[model samples]
Target: MKNPFRLPRRASLSRPWRWLVPLLLVLLFLAVLIWLPWQARQMEANERQEQLIADTLWVEQTLRFELARSEEALAVLGADLVSKPPTPEQLQARLNQMFKNGHELRRVLWLGADGAVLAHHGLELPPAGLAKVGRETLEMARLTRAGRYTEPYGASAHAPGMVDYYLPLFKRGEYAGSLVASYSLKVLLDETVPWWFAQDNDLALLDRDDHPIAERADGGPGRGIYTHRRALDLPGSSIVLATDSVKGTPRLLPNLLVGSVIVLALGLLLSLMTLWRHISRTLAAEAALRQQMAFRTAMENSLLTGLRARDLEGRVTYVNKAFCQMVGLSAEELVGKKPPMPYWAPEAMKDYEERFAGVLAGTITPQFETVFQRSDGVRVPVLVFEAPLVDSRGRQTGWMSSILDITDRKRA
Candidate 1:
């Protein structure tokens, strides 16, 4: 004989599905939630590193441009020195004026074709002289009949370091003389680098050997998390501009967020399992009625969307976990609350009133948009879907709302 107590075939097939599908969904959701934050953090780190590289290139170009400008200005002086034949006293006055304008330049000198100093400005002429100290660049200038920058020199225990720029003077294919401009690396950085940029990074001028020539660190040394190096394309020098940013890497998730997710997930899993066991034990007593209520409650609690149920009298009869968390309030503070809800945005009061009126008049717009203010005063945009709440007897009892926080969707 067919057993009178046996479950229907369809019901037996669906039994595992009732619990298993939700369990798999929860696990999948957890994996996605963890991955999204980690991926975002990685992107943020790469963006910061890229930004540092771009800014370092900009500073390098700025320094190069300033030096090139000083080189051009010296050429104009050399032309006058060759053609007009200004007196030593007059040339000295002009060099002083140039010094006032070219902040990067430490000195200026005029060298005859025979390598004798004609007239100079800013500090006494060095005892060793340019011919012996920076012979390669000076010779290159004479042979090419063009211009060149000397290798940086004089950074010893007794003297300060400087770079020399030569603007060769040629008259009818014959080398006449050259105008030489000197640069202090320290002054070049101080005058060329912007204050705001320097304040956020440690900038160092490095030689080919990676030795620090000069440095500017307004906000102290970097944490080494974000850094970049760019070379200044000067022929006689392999000076690199290196920057270390003060900013650090972004965190993947906050402690509060991780803790909350863990606690909520554990609680949900435990509640579902407990309810499942209770239903298993009482299935023969009131299978239809108890099974339906248990399934509905567990499903509602597991949702990420906020759920709300109201009695026909406009009183809040129930609220789910997501709703309380969405508004930054506890469930006890939200349940049984009347109109003028704490979560309602004051600026959207009229909109809320009209919607509440519709709920009381036995009708509701199937779906609509609204804003809710969190307890912290942050506004959250939401899309709400409303339907008629039905009783076990299939009679309409109240209004049910499924609220989805659409802040991310709206932002996108």
Candidate 2:
């Protein structure tokens, strides 16, 4: 009889190609899930550092501007004091005029030829020993005789909370005793320090000696002005400002284990899906084959026969209808079950296993025949043919086998 079993006529689809597509997609999905979040956190930290640098530069500029303005106002007042040594009434008038100009001078001092407090404004005339302390203020004013802004002097007898600006007065280019303007730190804060209050910042003006002579802020020791070197010349005072730091979100390892598991799950799912599609199409094709095979069986089924189809593992995957009928078992009962060694003809088991192993190893193609035993203890002959089952990449996976019952030819 012509061979009843045959290969599918046209390549309906490449089964191996179908399975590989999903495997690659699953790997791609895992790569994206892990990489995106880590990059975002690195970007946020860099932005915070830049903003802190900008705020510090703003404070340093404001301090320099206010100091320059104070020195200029003191120079104008100093010129008048030395040009005229006036009556007591005239000295009081000049002091009142300076105060009315909205400057924060707490005391005005006039030094004599021998550095004595010859006349002063805004101080009680102290007794002899007490009034002698104004000599230090005269010594500071002596430095400005050459005409430049003098540094701050610590509080003298009459004024304790103050910084001084001294200027030498001249008439006809002749040397004269100096005029000194004493500034109240409180008035300086009231005029210039309010502008720094926004953005939670505190500003302090310190003397060259690092004593805090003026402050526009209250509370907290956030005071480390020297920590930022740009504020160094603003001397004695430290400026500190802070904002609530942006809280970082918790980082979960979204892509580490989760990505790997997801990829694996997808791979398994794709594999299963491919397997299901494969099995489904194979079953449909097999059903069509069964119809054609049924007619051949009807012509040949009268004599009892044995059939077995094995994979490369020597486990049976299919059985013909005639063989199923002879064993009195359904095809499901025989599939995936191993054939008994004793039922096989002598020496067939070794040959079958070796051939199946060769097919699995890709060392040989598979197609052969051997005797088989039926459920009724009948020795019957069968023919089996196998082909290498592989992926599109041509890697061998398993084998597909078909069996034909050949008992009638043997019996006849």
Best by lDDT: 1
Q: What is the TM-score of each candidate against the true structure?
A: 0.61, 0.42
Residue 70 of model 2 has an lDDT of 53
Tens digit per residue, CA lDDT, model 2, 144-167: 454333344444444434555445
- lDDT by residue (74-131, candidate 1, tens digit) is 8788888778988878877878888888777887878888878887788676666664
330: Cα error in model 2, Å: 24
Candidate 2: Cα lDDT at 103: 53
* Model 2 spans with C-alpha error above 4 angstroms: 1-64, 81-94, 100-103, 116-119, 123-144, 147-160, 195-199, 206-214, 223-412
What CA RMSD would candidate 1 show? 25.4
Report model 2's TM-score to 2 decimal places.
0.42
Model 2: worst 10 consecutive residues (lDDT sum): 236-245
User: What C-alpha lDDT values do all the predictions have?
Assistant: 0.80, 0.54
